[model samples]
Target: MEETISIKDIFKTLKKRWKLIMLLTLIAALISGSISYFLLTPVYQSSTQILVNQKQSKNQLDSTQIQSNIDMINTYSVIIKSPAILEKVIDVLELSQSVDQLSQKITITSQENSQVFSLMVQDSNPLRAVEIANAVSGTFQKEIKDIMNVDNVSILAKAELKENPTPVKPNPLMNIAIAVVIGLMAGIGLAFLLEYMDNTIKDEKDIETILDLPLLGAIQKISKVHNKG
Candidate 1:
């Protein structure tokens, strides 16, 4: 037989399972908050900007020279992550990580048609991240002169340690909000599924709907009581 649902039925199901829905939402929010606040490690990011300043013989900037400098930024980005630059930075900083491992935390970014590029590093320690960023940029600035036989790299800004630092990931409020939404959806779906699967007759309405029978009357049971005199 085909089953039809009404708004009233939907409301009835939700009302019946309100406790389950509330419990699931609360649990999800609590777990998400707990993981975000306690379980996950906070990562701090620091960045230093380097400029590709190619000296021109003329006072005004040359278009061809500017384009060449911009194009070379791509090469510089890769070179910054390479062992040629990272090895020196690691050795200078006395970092325990390998070139590949250190490279994973470093990101090189440059804007289109802009000579300035940023060297970003993320670490659990904010001061360490700053130190790594400055070290990598400084090493790249010094080594590029030897590797490419050009002295065009200049440190525009060095990464500085902040008085108070904040992590970029594992936002507890956002995580909890998302978890609450997912939990509500899951709880509602489960509630309807359970309601659909239950076959036991509970009331006169269920009997009438499932059995297709008219109830003349319902039998009432009388309770016996004993009195002592």
Candidate 2:
């Protein structure tokens, strides 16, 4: 015979196992919050903007020149992360990290149809992130002339260490919220699984459903009450 479940059965199972579900959720939240707050290292980001513009003799800006500069941003992005620039930056900054390790922390982004691009760096220390960002931009600016025969790159804005910089990673509340959701889902799944696995008859409803038979008479327990004599 095929067996099926109803909404009522689902609610009944959840109601009976509410305590277990809550316990799982609470445990997950605590674990996630603890890891996020105490165990995970916080990463900080710093960014510096650089412009790819040459000093034009004529005051009027040429559209073709501007378009060419914008198109060069992609090539510049790769060159900034190359060993030619990163190795120089590492040597100048006295950093212990290799070119590949430093390159992993650096990122470049540019606006659409614009000559300006940003160099972003992330590190466990906010001051270090800022220092790396500025150093990378400076090294790239100095080396591009020799590498590409173009003296067009200039630092527009340098990354700075703030007095009260905030880390960009290890958001505790978000992690906890995600954990709570996962735990809730897990709890609900376990609840339904347990209900499915249990086959013991509990009451008249189970007897009638499983045996396909109507409940007959039942023996009632009689309690004796003694009156004051």
lDDT of 2 by residue, 1-229 (tens): 1234676677889999998899899999999999999999999999999999977998999999999999999999999999999988888889999999999999899889999999999999999999899889988888999999999999989999999999889888999999999999999898889889999988788989999999986767799998998
Best by lDDT: 2
How does each model score on TM-score? 0.89, 0.93
Can you write out model 1's per-residue Cα lDDT over 131-227, one digit (the tens) per residue?
Answer: 9999999888888999999988999999998999999876888999999999999899989999999999888889889989897787677899989
Query: What does candidate 1 score on TM?
Result: 0.89
Query: Tell me, what's the RMSD of every candidate?
Result: 2.7, 2.6
**lDDT for each of the candidates?**
0.91, 0.92
| Residue 78 lDDT in candidate 1 | 93
